[model samples]
Target: MIACSAELYCAADLLTRASLGELDVDIVAIVSDKPAAGELAAQHGVPFRLVDGGLAGDSRAEQEAAFAAVLDELEPDLVVLARYMRILPEAITVRWNGRMINIHHSFLPAFAGAKPYHRAHQRGVKLIGATAHYVTAELDAGPIIAQGITPVSHRDEVEDLVRKGRDVERTTLANAVRLHLEHRVLVWDNRTCVFA
Candidate 1:
């Protein structure tokens, strides 16, 4: 559970599944500042923690230091950013390097960053999608891991597109994480060669 952003309940579902050994991984720790997100971690019997609160306006170095401490405790082989809104520091990006992943709400190299569904709706795109990729300093411009798409039409509103996008985001992220945990995804020069 990250910032507890929209559709964060998916985090609960993913972590629950992972706890049940569906992904052959363990939820060593979950870091979020929100009580609700922390509760999700607790419900899954995962240790919950917090990093930069944003109210202090901490520098990237400070934030990275805090995050490093958390990772030190968890010793996770991979870092998954599910609905985590903050753009991480280059230090943390480089430190984690190929071990980190994120799920974006857009098909990517397209409407990235905040509110992609709204932008796609405004542009009248026939299809909107989600992407999961290795985390790098270049924001959403990272090595592609997986992509999931769903069709939409002129009649669909932004809200409808958002609802549909959530489904894509959830499944795409889950699949990417599962592939990574299973050692089925290989990264090479900003692209992924998935074995399955």
Candidate 2:
């Protein structure tokens, strides 16, 4: 598995027990600019490779090249973006295709972008949730695999809502990854039917 964000550490820990050596999913490499992410990889004894350029501002060619370099070196079977905050080029998306997945902070087709917790708070919604889906070029607009929702109250603040949302996010993403690893998710017309 190729983990791209901090939340991936949690996913990795979860996988350690669930796969029970069946997958033996070694975290071949991790890409992040954050020191904490690097530290986590080091603690887990996984090799860390830093992206050479800024993902958001770098040209598509540069980003693709960098991603290709990592793929060449890691040759990961699956790419999991656990809160990695960068848009992937279409070339890479097509190359990896179904082998990639991402976790979003909101039930997709609703709050699909960043600050979803704040968006839910502003809307005064009574429930907030997270979505896990395939990594399509259309940001957060991918086939849904799994989701988890939690109720909010009138007294809840943005931070409180985000805190509650994190738990759901972690569990939902883990479930999605497990299903994908087990080949239990079948995609059809931008939607998913997961066995789990």
Candidate 3:
């Protein structure tokens, strides 16, 4: 399992649960570009590697090389982006394709860019949700595997929506990862059929 995020305290908790036999998966390694993230990885007792040049500034070649190095070293069957917050280059996306998964903070095709929760709120949408999908070259556009929705009341603010959306994000991502690991997801025409 790959843990990415400053608030990966959630990821750490999930990893601990998995380690305690709550989930039938092996977390081979954890990667982060932040020092605090690395500290959290250490607290979880998992080996950690730091990606070079952070996420945004790194050129396509640099980012791809860094991820490729990790893939070569870890040899994971799949790469899960647990809030890594980086737009992967097409070269890397094509290389991993269906094997790479990402969790987006919106129901997707709805708010496909940054600050999706805020966008949903600004648009006065009745519901805010999260989507889990395969990593594709085009931004958040990908084959959607699963999604979770939460009711957004008129009383809710952007922060409230974001907080609720984070819950859905974690669950959606974990569900998608589980389905992918079990070989229960099939992609067709920019969507997915999950059998579980």
Candidate 4:
């Protein structure tokens, strides 16, 4: 399962790269509340589903349950959270466990959660980075699997950082996914022992 929100850039990047046989697994479906996400799945020749937290606009628990049911039905070996923009409850995370991962825009242990790039820029940080890791209940605090970074000068604006962050996010996430696919990552004590 591949979950996403409004924009499909990250999802498209991952699906495109995955389709090239970099890994043995297949992208069975893309789930989202955004229609454009489903359109992206269609363009990429993958199945799509809209998970609206049920038709009644129910509670958080209901929404989570609906998503969990969808995943249960899909039975995918792995789930990639590509700019998914939703915080899942513990129930689903426990079920997916090591099988789930996400790409965070910051190097992590810094600027975690949403709008990381914007925050990093606001702090006038010189170097920005991206981190891909297993999706633990703690937001973006999972075991680090792979990372990518680039320098940002003072002259560079927030938009510039956001642009550069996108590159880092893409490569970092791809590397992490590749490592996971190849079974090259071992987790312990909330850290990763990545085998080359």
For lDDT, the strongest prediction is: 4
Angstrom error of the Cα, residue 141, model 2: value is 0.7
lDDT for each residue of candidate 1 in 1-196, tens digit (9 for 90 to 100): 2333334655775786786777777667777644467777777787877675553687656665777778776768888888877788887788888888889999998997888999999999999999999989998999988999999999999999988988888889889888988899888888889997
Give lDDT: candidate 3, residue 25.
78
CA lDDT of each prediction against the hidden true structure: 0.80, 0.76, 0.80, 0.86
On residues 9-51, what C-alpha lDDT tens digit does candidate 3 reach at each position?
4466458667777656777878776656777777768888877
Clashes of 2: 0
lDDT of 1: 0.80
Judge candidate 3 at residue 73 and give its lDDT. 77
Per-residue lDDT of 25 in model 2? 57
Better of 2 and 3 by lDDT: 3
> TM-score, each model?
0.90, 0.87, 0.90, 0.94
Give the worst 10-residue stretch by lDDT in candidate 4. Answer: 51-60
Greater lDDT among 3 and 4 belongs to 4
Candidate 3 segments whose C-alpha is farther than 4 A from its true place = 54-60
Which whole-number lDDT from 0 to 100 does residue 171 have in model 1? 87
The stretch of ten residues in a row with the least summed lDDT in candidate 3 is 5-14
lDDT of 1 at 64: 58
Residue 88 miss distance in model 2 (angstroms): 0.6
